[model samples]
Target chain A: MTDPKKTVSVKPDADQALKARNGRNIALALGLVAFVALVFVVTLVRLGANVGNRF
Target chain B: MAKPAVLSPDTPADTVRAARWQDYFQLLKPRVMSLVVFTAATGLVAARTHIHPLLGAVAVLCIAVGAGASGALNMWYDADIDAKMRRTRGRPVPAGLVEGSEAATLGVVLSLLSVLLMGMAINWLAAGLLAFTIVFYAVVYTMWLKRWTAQNIVIGGLAGALPPAIGWAAAAGDAPLNAWLMVLIIFLWTPPHFWALSLYISTDYAKAGVPMLPVVKGAKETRKQILLYSLVFIPVCLAPAATGLGGPLYLAVSALGGLVFLTLAWRVFRSDAGDAADPRVADRALYDVAEAPAAEAAPAVEGKRPPPVGGAKDARNLFAFSILYLFALFAALLAEAMIGIRALELPL
Candidate 1:
């Protein structure tokens, strides 16, 4: 049986664990975003899509 | 100020001051501020107004500072709802690094200072816009619309989209219809961009007692609205191409980007909203600030968590792409501006 006080208290590593997870999650998400952006840019370049030059 | 001998007078106060400074900065949401600055800079440059570079820089600074001030004030006021949301639980106010009252005071002071300086240094039109943006964000969006309606981000996007136009007006002395058209595009884009996120994080918003569209209308209704907004956004996004501001490059990218955006919106629209399927996937992929493994705790969140707190699978991905979408859209605008600059330099 755990002590009630101890049970309710958050572990010291809880914050650290949460932080690690957050960092990894953000990295993974950013990677996918970068990939999508890369694909979009490459596709535009390959197609000679000059959206930027028309104005 | 009397130095209290009892409160460790011998210890250098610089460390304490630095700690306090970091906390104050965090309250302003610096990451969001960076995006505001980039978009505003794009707006200013896109206007192609020939102002001294130094003055242009100053105008941009004022806009960024004003934006920061508004963010701080918002954090101060929304601390309650913020504390309840898992995504916001680690914000400076919720984390207890800064007192709510102090954050409010900093916000108000900075808001006043930023606006006054901008009016003096920049044109009143830009200054006026800056002033209104602060009020719209801090008073209208944060205090009222955020609580009263699901259409909050939709209407509230105007404030976020204003910085670039304000920056442009500061340089050009008047924001042209083109600048305003850019603003309109962002305004229309806000709903689909945000609602896709809301569809997944409906529970967190619900838990916080903020009656987001999904909470009041349910998942199917929210999904439908997301599609409706996307349909509206696609046509509006193309409007810039016909204007003096956009060209072939702008048109092509807008078309392609719009297609992708529409496809995602369609997927979200067609997905099952029934009880078994994890509806929170979009939000989980988008705003995964804490990044906990979705499969592990996601089921728990979906099943036991009330309608308001459950996060959908892939929500983090959706949240993330929303950021990218905004970035890409503005980058295209900057590219158009560059093209215009080159054209202006052409000798007949």
Candidate 2:
């Protein structure tokens, strides 16, 4: 028969892996957000001259 | 943010796993978003008003993001039913890949961002449509109509159908008659497309207790309704040509595709429910028999998984064709717009 204490002991490594994965995902998401923001800024700058001419 | 809990050095390795980034992405329903992007882009292009290319790209992106947001919110809210249904069991929330609350938070954040960006970059009208679409899908459809009515897809389809109108509004600052006509075609197409799928997968829905058309109306009525919707959908497909949105190319494709779509629906209607024999099964068995040596060949395995059966095959065929029909219709619209093709008009 398995010991209850031994069964409970397996959670720590799994918890650590979960934390690491979550951290990586959060970082990636932030990077994507920043990239989109950069694109928005560039587009505004590039199109500013055209906007004045068209209007 | 809270720090990770300190575990003893002897801690065991069986702890619960966290969701991967792909799991979170899957909550967005990227396949469905692709359809939204294509239809919306077609609408934008088909509009008489010209938009700056960069802004047009932004508008399409916002629409795609908004569609994704709606999908996430749907998965979050429908986690209960999703877990019960086999088809949706592996979805992020239901599969425990992402917490339901996390999905809801992502949905809300993306929804606000997409709408706000669209309003700033495009126009308020388009932004407003985007906001309404997200709410309609998340709250009106998923939370209310889906569980409450057998006509869920019929009504919920409006949310999916609105992207093209939103795109039109984004480009022209208002949707004209042609844009609305495109929306109507999608709205009519949705019932037949989804009901065909539901006919075969009714057992899954029955187990999930979702009150789909097949669950509530029975297969006979569902088939009849599918045929009716298909008949109605064909004329709507042709209407775009009369409105000058579709040219000769569009007319030809719509006419041929509509005929095939109607025929498949008719076949589905004629097939008896619960018929397990499929002609394809016989064809395959015959092929195997021809390939085998009489003395050395083993007898065919009995009770193997049967081929897709009578109504099931027709349902599957209709479902597959429905997707092709929509894509081809939209592609033709895109082609017409690009090439400056329009139907010839006769003076009355």
> Top model by DockQ, which number?
2
Best by TM-score: 2
Candidate 2 docking quality: incorrect, acceptable, medium or high: acceptable
**TM-score of chain B in each prediction:** 0.83, 0.87
Report iRMS (Å) of candidate 1.
Answer: 13.5
| Fnat of each candidate | 0.00, 0.22
Score each candidate by Cα lDDT: 0.71, 0.81
Q: After superposition, how far is residue B199 of candidate 1 from its true place, in Å?
A: 1.3
Scored by lDDT, the top model is 2
lDDT of 2 by residue, A1-55 (tens): 9877556555676676677687767967895897588467746855798899997
List where candidate 1 sits over 4 angstroms from the true fold.
Answer: A1-55, B1-19, B273-286, B289-319, B339-348
Tens-digit per-residue lDDT, B139-228, candidate 1:
999999999987888888889888878988988999888889878877877777677667666777888899888788888887788779
Model 1, A1-55: lDDT tens per residue? 8656434334544564466456546764774696466445444543453676676
> lDDT tens string, model 2, B156-186?
9999999899999999999889999899999
